[model samples]
Target: MATRRKEYRFRNGKIIEIEENHDGNYGAPGQKRIKKKKPTEEQMRLVNINNKVKRCRHKLLEYFNAGDCFGTWTYSQANRPPDMKAALKDFQKTIRIVRIEYKKRNRELFWIRNIERGTKGAWHIHFVVNEIGDTASIMQKAWKKGGIYAVEIRNEPKVYDEDFSKLAAYMTKDEHTKEIKKDGTPAKPRLKETSYNTSRNMPLKKPHVDKLVRWKNEVKPRKGYYIISIHEGINPVTGFKYRRYTMVRFPEPKRKVQLKRRI
Candidate 1:
């Protein structure tokens, strides 16, 4: 009887051939099989960090869509810009001041802040914020340590999704701040930086997970909270599959009580 052969192409463009003998054996006898190496500790740590960053970005997007997001704004550095670390500190302090003043006026504010490098390699600030009244002027006045600023309210629903995805992609893009040396070691220790920030009062995401049943079955109809989105991924460290649900909880609806005694 003639043997049947099959070929498989991997993502790396490697072609592997397999033959079946009369006895239904796949590989030839004494042919050693190459085993996949487990991920190194450093690699696993990097994977975990990547997953965490992605989840945080998605949560920020969910927060933006679940409620009213005022707009997206950018703040550029002035002619004499401070160091990145110092500039970030000053930026955060200004934001806190803005939040405090807004609250004093009995207005609520929520913000998602992102820091990025501009075309000239200068650090800039981006924010998706919700605040009562006109905030662009206030932000401009507060961020006096920068050059120019712009704010555009997100009008269209489709634009929100597009902008959200773009922001997430930008935040997660490969960072060029660190370089790899020829010896496979990093040239210098990367400076710790906050990629993004969110308001403290932002809604906390609720996770609903079920292995044997669908997501709908696992999540019940809650009064204050509603499901925003669901994401499925494998844990990089444990390799365990999981389904994460992003939920938004609003102020509970008021219930009416009957006056039975009067009746």
Candidate 2:
């Protein structure tokens, strides 16, 4: 007994808004506080897994670009000279070739710098260049080009794995893994950030070569940041001798500009 139009009529026997039908939504006139229903356990798990996959993919791609050889760099304090800017520029110039080669070989290089402390204790960048083979040679060239004695050494490294399935599988079905509400329908899993950080082989600690000295007000300005005037132990690897002058323990805040981005 119903016609084509009647078949789509509302229960109240009124024709539904043509626009609402096309849009799949009725423009409700009143304010309605629609509380987002909490996701079921399975939904949450799926979301978490999805997030995990995203993070892993991101990191894997980053590693691929940087060649998975990321680490902080350090040079001998004794090798530091009167000027610090000159040293970094020289080193950068030497490193430029490595960058070029990475592109030539279709590899990626990612450099990250954390709380720099080189010849001048300035912020230094750490990178994971795409090509792994030429690191030693590049460092040697940087040393020669930099003309600075502080050796270029990598420290505190972390590598990313490309195999996403294996990397993702680790978080499967673990109750401890947290989840996020995904944007799309029936939100799929997205891995938690904490889980990713833990599993990605990320370095838990940073290289801290705090040159401490006990010079009473004798702290003098060196290359870039003011030097604490260290009077101490030689590095086992480099075998460079630091002047026995005691370093001034400047408060942590001032240390950055006062003694950052050195070597």
Candidate 3:
């Protein structure tokens, strides 16, 4: 088996994944292949949702950085849309206005949006958008029917790794997971729907893959970068060890000013 590695570089950090490559042929000639059981429908659903979450996280890290805004937007009682369709339409309209506002200032808008309904059937929106000079103000003015509550993303390595993972999980949370209602009774999951959306301006870079030649046993950081986290697991199907880690550049120190002695 050949060792393979993949490297993904983002705006704030980088991820490296390494694993063993198993050839497509499962067995040698005349070898009886064991038939694996097919995945149940529910299992397949969860797998798909998990994949969506990973993809969402990758995009968020690739395009967004510190000082960006991440928050939820809700509609007033009177302005609540009747259905998901209407909610999406209103959201699209609002974003279109936001894009125009950014364009007017010669800034390009990059955003990721997700829409979901609460147990009571009320709809709301979650978003991650690049912060310009007037992002909050523009969004607030454009979304007249709702009040936008936003918080700025912190300038930290964890914000790009752990925090982004949490954000992406929430934004892409599927309706397939069973949950308890407020009444303490098990509630049925809602119908599966779209996971999330990204603006066309987002640019996703392809990861570089090659034969694994370094860091096979120990997770080490590069000269100018530091490791944020490392995860190790075994692939059930392949029975091979898998490892992934994240690295971020060290922040440069501020220049010190020297005081001059007067004669």
Candidate number of the best TM-score: 3
Task: Report RMSD for candidate 2.
Answer: 29.4
CA RMSD per model (angstroms): 14.4, 29.4, 5.0
Q: Cα deviation in Å at residue 23, candidate 3?
A: 7.6
Error of 2 at 119 (Å): 14
Cα lDDT tens digits for candidate 2, 1-263: 11011011121211111100111121223534333455677667666665565444334332333233443344455644334465456446646776676666676554432123332243233333333666555544545422221222223222232222233333222334333457544433332111112223332221123322222333343332233223343323222222322112233454444656767
Q: Residue-wise lDDT of candidate 1 within 1-263, one digit each (tens)?
A: 22332222111211111111121222235554333458888768678656555555545554444234433334443433455676577767888888887887888766766665544555666666654556766776776655544445345343344324444534443343355689987765233333566677755343322122112225342355455455455655444344434344555569999777864
State model 2's lDDT.
Answer: 0.35
Off by over 4 Å in 2: 1-67, 79-91, 100-115, 118-125, 144-263
What pairs collide in candidate 1? none
Regions more than 4 Å wrong, model 1: 1-38, 41-46, 66-81, 117-121, 152-163, 172-194, 213-263
Q: For candidate 3, write residues 1-263 as lDDT tens digits.
A: 34567777776344432223433224334575435556677667766776687677777767776678877788889998878788888988999999999999999888888887766666678888999877878878888767787777664332344527667766775566565689998778763443378888766677777774333567678778787767676644445456767777778899999999999
| Top candidate (lDDT) | 3
